[model samples]
Target: MSESTTPLVWLVIRKDDNGNRYRIGSYATKAEAQQIADRLDDRGPKQLYWVERAGQGGAQ
Candidate 1:
């Protein structure tokens, strides 16, 4: 298990009924991410994906 001392928040927002669904979040693992997804109201055909960090770069 990949455990991070720092906690993160997961978010899913849709622009409208006709518009596409947008998945946004900050999470340490997929287990935590799935928890957040289960709490949402399903009203569309869109899916959710994770957003990864792109920093600390090749420099590290």
Candidate 2:
């Protein structure tokens, strides 16, 4: 997908091919995303990611 479709800042993680989740979430910003990534990484087990790309969908 192009960068347009993909937001400049998004939830990135070490997940499987498909969006298979298996951990904590609710990150609303780039900083929050990075914070969660680091926290989870230290905890180990490579829990599935829960990255909800903000700004893509919402009710006006």
Candidate 3:
């Protein structure tokens, strides 16, 4: 498939204590994004990590 046609449907987002959100990375699969988010979440509790659809509202 072409790069433009391949959808990056998964987004890994991080939110800090100040309530600011950032898009850490994008992945073609939810499982891949979730694994990265889970690993980051485990490293510390100061920040929060989660996965959502790319255009849903979590992150862009």
Candidate 4:
């Protein structure tokens, strides 16, 4: 196996009523992801979140 040191990106997902998560996109920074979520304010009722992998540099 190969070691991956590259930081994991921030993932934006939309959750459905059935508890299904749909991936939207991933960003290298939390700010970028939050910006997207903010822009989606007028879209509809959505379960939005910023997810980062372990060892990734981002706000906890």
Ten-residue stretch with the least lDDT total in model 3: 51-60
How do the residues 1-60 of candidate 3 rate in per-residue lDDT, one tens digit apiece? 887787888999998888889999988889999999989988966688899996699532
Every candidate's CA RMSD:
7.9, 10.5, 2.9, 6.4
Please tell me which model should have the higher TM-score, number 2 or number 3: 3
Which model, 1 or 3, shows the larger lDDT? 3
Q: What is the C-alpha lDDT profile of model 2 across 1-60, one tens digit per residue? A: 664564445554456546454334444467777777777677756555444455443221
Q: Candidate 1: where is the Cα deviation over 4 Å?
A: 1-16, 42-60
Q: How do the residues 1-60 of candidate 1 rate in per-residue lDDT, one tens digit apiece?
A: 335666554433333455554545556655666655555534346444333332311111
For every model shown, what is its TM-score relative to the native structure? 0.37, 0.38, 0.81, 0.57
Clashing pairs in 1: none
User: Best candidate per lDDT, number?
Assistant: 3
Q: Which sections of candidate 4 miss by over 4 Å?
A: 1-8, 45-60
Best by TM-score: 3
Candidate 4 residues 1-60, lDDT tens each?
Answer: 233654546766656778666667776677777777677744767555455543454343
Candidate that beats the other on TM-score, 1 or 4, i.e. the better one? 4
lDDT (C-alpha, whole model) for all candidates: 0.45, 0.54, 0.87, 0.61
lDDT assessment of candidate 2: 0.54
Rate residue 43 of model 4 by lDDT.
73
Alpha-carbon RMSD, candidate 2 = 10.5
